[model samples]
Target chain A: MNLRTLLEEKKSSIVKKWVHVIFEQYPPDSTNFFLTQKDRFLNPVGHAISEGARDIFNALVDDSEPEKFYPLLNDIIKIKAVQDFSPSVAISFLFLLKKVIRVEAGAEIARRNLTPELEALESRIDQLILLSFDIYSKFRERIFEIKNDEFRRMTFRLLQRANLICEIEGEKTTPGEETVITNK
Target chain B: MAVQKPEELSKVVYTFPSTPWMDTPVEIKKGIFCWGNKEKSLKAVGFPNPRQWSVTDEDWKLPDNWKEIFIEGLRERVDKYRSFRLFLDICVRCGACADKCHFYIGGGDPKNMPVLRAELLRSIYRKYCTTSGKIMGKVAGARELTTSVIKELWYYAYQCTECRRCSLFCPYGIDTAEITILIRELVNLLGLNIEWIAGPVANCWKTGNHMGLLPHTIIDIVSEFKEAIYQVTGLKVDLSYNRKGAEILFVHPSGEYFDPNGNVTFMGYMMLFHEIGLDVTLSTYSSEGGNFGFFTSNEMAKRLHSKIYAEAKRLKVKWILGGECGHMWRVWHQYHNTWFGPVDYLEEPVSPITGTKFENAKSNKIVHITEFTADLIRHGKLNLDPKRNDKYVVTFHDSCNTSRAMGLFEEPRYIIKNVCNNFYEMPPQTIRENTFCCGSGSGLNASENMELRLRGALPRGNAVRHVRDKFGVNTLANICQIDRATLQTLVDYWAKGVAVRGVHELVGNALVMKGEKERTTDLRGDPLPGKEGE
Candidate 1:
């Protein structure tokens, strides 16, 4: 298969596997706090990814433009790579997904008796999510070079706005005092 | 009312000493201040009020109230300029402007860095204006004002010749001289100004010119020179003054009225105009073409510059011809067009003789003495005897403001080559945009800053020595009156065998009038009249 087709198929399988993992991580208990907090925090992450994906898909459909979608996908992979998310961090995310999938699989087992086929599906889902995060992390550096001064300045300003870089209180000495001493 | 005698004034009132050096000989000091206690010191004898002087060692210890009043006035003046904000905001500190500064390159001081020099004003601006500065202070590299800061400002502001060389190299096209002017204005407001500068400025305000010569005294000096011209060339030139309805008002630096080298150039200007039969009259009221206030404060600068328009109005002249003074042209060419408004009484400068319109304000309306002479020669209007100035090998010293700021590179050289037998140039960078100062320019020539002045003169002195040793150049010619005066002092003390003269002085020496007697004296005080063999 061509790279584009192979990548699209791989992305589709990874997304399906992640969705199953998310379901397993949240149990069906009526008062589950993790599920309640998921909508507040994790939902935004999901919403942002979905929005990015939808924009890429729309650009592809409108002009049959592969150049447009390819860069966006590359950028997401680059961000994942340079962040140097430890293999453990990726595995932890997979483990969380595994828990959600297990709960869904448990519900299925309860509705009908436990089966070997259901357990095998859960293992396959776990392996797929882990592999996708690993691949994304490896290609992060090349993605960063696409965004130059404008993008860097924008991103820097955004991070500053978010209080990612700490700021200290004003100095006790006034400007007049420092300049006078230095110039003298 | 009778004017007060120089002796009647207190010695303390008039004496302003420049910076002292560690190893300055007592003899050198004595020679520089030869006027001594007779109230003859140029710095001391000029001031009207002697008792108001305070001899404080520190600049900060001056009257606090006067300082506050002056600073407030300066702030008001600077606040009126909206372009200053753009200049303050635009510098990227790329350091491209460092090598462009003659002082910075010659001295090798980091503070002389153009961006850093401009930052002296910019940092103060940020402290008071920006939000980040108001909140974070030194984290944003802002600081408050203090006594030492004021002193440092004076030191660096004086270092700049206000030549505008840095403006050409700046990517954003910011002129640091504008900042230097602002700092000087602010300093003047504080009453923490140099005495030598204030003395001349006050004189320019009280008298018509900076030298404090009375109308009759000026008449006597001009009449003496006119007699000298007649004795030499047998030409009775009409050099009148304060006469109403003159077609053109001719202005020159007051230094030209007394100095021998300056007189040669003045005589050259007279001979050329007399030959052309141009209707020009010298102004006894405002004879000084050079503005010392340009190196000091804008209020004082405006006060001194206003006299030009006032004199023109008084005389009903159509145009004014500026003589060969560096800063004089800088003020007229760059600032006069902006500061003086609706000058409808005078038409834009059109050469009354050639009928050619001068559009470039810097070089056009205000013609250099060299350009005027060169143009005359180009048109074959005057009969020049090039052998008259053949006594010594000559080289030209292009003043930075003229050659670099005004792009007057060829006219002076062309005039020199046409008049003198052997003409040479100093090493490439030392002559044109990179020409060194005589160390006494920008008003630092006063006896007060002898050490700094000597240090600054080193580069120019060395450059002259190069030409003297390599080409056996016995005479150096320049167009700026200040260059003549300052280099006279430098060459006398440092370069013993070489002498400096104005370019016009050489031209005038070579000039032979129609059916007139041949002139005898060359610009170097040499008797070149009948020495056709040498």
Candidate 2:
């Protein structure tokens, strides 16, 4: 069978596998609920993961335009970006996509004359994976910036009780500057 | 292992150390706080102690008399609001409210505990205001008003969603919400207002809306909404604006006019009004039913809330109908009469369509849109087909204010159940008076406070997650505009597939308008269940 036709045929199963692989990072209890629930509305996390995975797979199959993937990738990655995944593990679904595709493609590809097409498809996936890191990094950066603001807010009470609201008034101060109250 | 989900956050993994909360200094943590207010936004509204400042600065540049101003402010508030004095003096360290605070429940932070949060301010109140605090000092549970104390108040006050769930459980009925509002008021006096809230308050004071949408901008947006209705349904929907002598003048949170889902809900309002041919006018002057000042101070709340009745009187409307909002109703129900009351010019609000006398709001002379719509549905006035909303298995999230402050329990749910075929309730504890705050409420919805918001949202998120696991419920219908903006982010982080929607948005989708084209999609432009699968 042609590579494109194989990819098209196995897309649903591939998206499912990719979602399961991504969800494995969560606790088993959570994963059970995230995976077992089928109702789209009730199993929102699972449904979203499926929908997001399906969109990414469809974009990958199109191959006509790769930019279509980012918007879809962004919607999912943003959730990941705010979620508790490490930088590498969070966007690592991009890597898992390759495995799902290869596993579904099967070893029969070696006998076929689809080597060039397979290599080209794999390389496109590689490039998209590289771009996915940028989205992951940017979102992580935003979360960091947000955390720094919160951290500073902790010491805000100390600053006020110490009579610090007006002495620094004339001086230009940058926003979200981390100042810990060391005063006893 | 990564804590990808709230359930994965082990109970043993403590949010705050077991060390004595009072003895230890508050260590700043990530994912639990945000930078303080901008100086510009504070100065715009003529807030006290206004000066250019940043939350990151080591120095806040306080006036020498800043301490005196705060004390006087406290004394004045104590005299003015009896609740303020009683909340401060009546607490006996009973732990009834400790576990009830959503912040403490979700974050596991001791300070998030309503008792501890009140203590942060109460210590100072005891210090300067009481004689024992002056004499015994630390021994009497009183601490001097130090920069650290002020900073601690800022940290803990914002952490509180001020939903008053804690107060409901308090033995002495010490309302931490009222206390928190006062702390924020005192904080605002020091120009420590967060930009997210201050900016909106400034805009609303000038332009009559939180988002700073001017009169012309509102007109253009409403006109565009009309155009979109025409384009989609092949029917004209012309909403009136600032029209004097109209039977009813409608006001909703400005967030509804701008946010995507909110706009869809507003469209639902338009469709309902248009279908019924109700003589309702949308007022550009009283465009916002929300009062951000309620989050800051009673005076600010009074200033902002004044626009409603003033505009109603100016426009000469018989009565007013308020749209779906949480805190707006809080202000309307509890504070409006106390603040800018005796709206005697406006007659008692009775729905012209269903002829339902809203006895609950007849005294206030303003009716909640949910009350109006639910009444309409009760009278069989609306041509609703529940099949239109078959795409959604929905659940209702009673916004904290509407739940606790107004007790608007069944009104919105009545509309949702009648409009949608499938409706599921979360744990009984999580709905009605016991409902959890969206966490981003009371001006904590700023992006800078994302982590605090996520952790604080955990209780509600976990509850919704439960229903999502049990039932096929994908949509969370709420009445608050803050929920419209913040709950979306909350759901995105905690539960991905679930979407946040206003109750009326569902009502509009189910509403079969006269002479409309065959409906293909809901108000949000999502395809109908039968229309799909083509």
Candidate 3:
């Protein structure tokens, strides 16, 4: 059997193991919560991990273009980006899927001699790790941007109230030469 | 070739570390922690052990007698406040409050769990105060109060917004906020405080406001508002400052003077007062309604709050009307009478226009603006045209203090439903008394802690995102001044395209004035809903 059929046959187990491994990166106390809690609103971090893992696995099996992975990668990365995780540890979950797949289906894969197919699938996972890095960097940059913007926005209205910031007038309109346009 | 399946690869088992929580060392990571208290701010307030220090430093430069002082302060607080003592004593660690914290929900840090956040101090409490803890030691969940534990306490105490969502879920009525408050007070004994809180406390203590706006500066800013009001409504609403015999003294969180959303809400109050011809005077002496000192210590809160009643007495106002603010009302409703009681100087607040007695505020004699306005609408005292707010699809975020602390659930909603044409409620769990915090409450809304604030904001943001997706909610209306200032950044980051505004901003937008100009725009100078072509 080919890798696609094998992955499809073991889709639920593979995805479950993948999510389990991803959650292991968190503190041991939180692992049970990240695994057990199912409410999306109540446990957003957990939801992102489980849902993002499933979505990434499906997209990989379906041969969806890598660009489709950005949003899926971004969903989990955004949570970890602000968390206490360092960059390497935050992005490490994306790389853990390969090990999970190997563990869950190693016997089936070797018996079927699907090593080449597995290597091909593993390369796609590597590509996703690179995508996660980009998403992680973007969020970190956005956080810094938010910090700077908050400082400016906090005092921005105060500046306007204090008359510290003046509105520079555009080129003065010539009397009777103002261009009037009809709304179409 | 025989495939060698790994010996332990049958199933994944999560191995929880053998080290118990007490043995797990605290690591104060950056982006989550605030900068240490500035020496100038600590000295300005006459707090003990004023000195420069950084959280990132190896040595926190604490006073040598810090531990003794901390234990003494804790003992005094536990004795003085029965609730603090009860909270420290009665927790069963039922885990009901574990998932309730917005910080824990967002960040997934086990430490952020309300149960554990409390235990960060409770462990020390166990080691020092309780008999079992002192005798049994680590087995009894007690540990030594080392410098590491102090850092942990400082880190987590500030993490709590004191929103009380956990307390609502607790079976024993344990208020983690009280524990956080007590821990903060103890930390302050060692001169460990965050700048966002210290700066405001110093400013409010010295200048009668958080912004340090002197009387002239406040008047100048009010005159600017006067001009803006004229531009909007074509009426010169009279504003009295420090004038005697005004009948009602108006105190507002000073953000209303300069914050864009708050300015419009202030304009709303001015317009409402003008329409009703109410006798009210704004005070430069007690210029700010927000008591940042409440975030510091009970004594400091009293010191900052004293000015309001003093100003009311000086102006000879019968009662006080506070502007839209969160913790200010918490301080007023919960602590005001206790701080300065038999407040016989000010009469029970009776709305001069509607003749409604604010019976709830009879003791403290300070009426929340929402309650006051809701009464006005009920009495048909002010002319309102809700259609002017047709552009906004409004959702009300019940500020944590107002809803959970004061049980002010319906007043703001009554006001918002009357003003805005389109209104939607976020999920039931995320509203009313169970509302999530704006994440910046309790003075955690500093720029340095942006990551922490944004992470803490997730639950509220997620709820907003839900409504924005389902109902296209475009505007988030709230009554709290801190909500007005902080929720905008929150919505911008989480639910893009949604704008945050005060409920009274909508009141200002929809209010029809007697001598108003042919209306072209709302208070923020935006075109009226259907008048886009104009």
Q: Rank by TM-score, descending?
A: 3, 2, 1
lDDT of 3 at B153: 92
Best by TM-score: 3
Tell me the lDDT of model 2 at B360. Answer: 80
Candidate 3 structure quality by residue, lDDT tens digits, B305-333: 99888888888889989889999988987
Docking class of 3: acceptable
RMSD of each: 26.8, 14.3, 6.0
Best by lDDT: 3
Task: State the lDDT at A127 in candidate 2.
Answer: 87
lDDT of each model, Cα atoms only?
Answer: 0.60, 0.77, 0.84
| Chain B superposition TM-score per model | 0.83, 0.95, 0.96
* Model 1 chain B worst lDDT window (10 residues): B30-39
lDDT of 2 at A73: 75
Worst 10 residues of 3 chain A by lDDT: A172-181
lDDT of 2 by residue, B63-89 (tens): 777788788888888888888888899
Model 3: pairs clashing at backbone N, Cα or C within 3 Å: none
